[model samples]
Target: MALSSSSEIVRRPHPLEAAIGDTRVLLDVEQGLYFGLNGIATSIWQRLEQPVRVSDLCCSLKAEYEGEAARIEAEVLAFLALLDARKLIEIRA
Candidate 1:
């Protein structure tokens, strides 16, 4: 899925999430698959507990880490795409 900063994201309802150390884990009940996320990816997952704009995610991540806006935006979009592909997240324009 093609995504931009303006896109909004929300976690899918069927996944159960848990945190272990610095990593976050998700179980997709229907698919019986496990997904793991670390570091900033975990942060992004946590933020998606509610529907949020990708731009807001970028801003929050930027404040937590030192990086260019464009770079952070790109990485966040990429990670979101991965989760979306796995049916773990819903993306809306």
Candidate 2:
């Protein structure tokens, strides 16, 4: 499975990026790409320091975004899938 916490790796922005950026924080860094993010994405990205389960991500979505949790979960998952397709994130194993 590609949902292991370790390979789902995330890193906090060190110094400069951390100092100024809140929503723009580095969620995942690879292949010379930097995905600037906002809102639940910012929340989820920060929490993804370890390989996180989809349910865990949904929890964060619930906490961050308003409206139905299930609705937010679907939206968040879809966005995550888009990111995955972009090679921005990978399923951890």
Candidate 3:
């Protein structure tokens, strides 16, 4: 499903998750899939500790990173799309 700036992101309840240095490891017990997150993804995951809107995430990241707003929004949306496709996150319109 396509995500818009207003879409809210929430982490799905998974079996396990761990933070190893700058990376985050997540496990889907029933699906038996292991996922790893690094760099900005790790930050994204941390932000998802609470449900947040895609636009808000982009705004915060844009302020923290040296990048164009459009670029940051596109990348954040793409990353959230991946997490959503993996069933690791839920996107609420």
Please tell me which model should have the higher TM-score, number 1 or number 2.
1
Candidate 1 local Cα displacement, residue 2, angstroms:
3.6
Query: What overall lDDT goes with each candidate model?
Result: 0.88, 0.58, 0.88
Question: How do the predictions measure up, each by TM-score?
Answer: 0.92, 0.61, 0.92
Query: Which residue pairs show backbone clashes in model 2?
Result: 2-91, 2-92, 3-92, 5-51
lDDT of 2 by residue, 62-84 (tens): 77567787687667667666666
Worst 10-residue lDDT window, candidate 2? 10-19
Global CA lDDT computed for model 3 = 0.88
Worst 10 residues of 3 by lDDT: 14-23
lDDT of 1 by residue, 1-93 (tens): 467889889888968878887778889989999999998888788888899999998999899999999999989988988998999988887
For model 1, the stretches where C-alpha displacement exceeds 4 angstroms are none
> If the candidates were sorted by their lDDT against the true structure, best first, what order would they fall in?
3, 1, 2
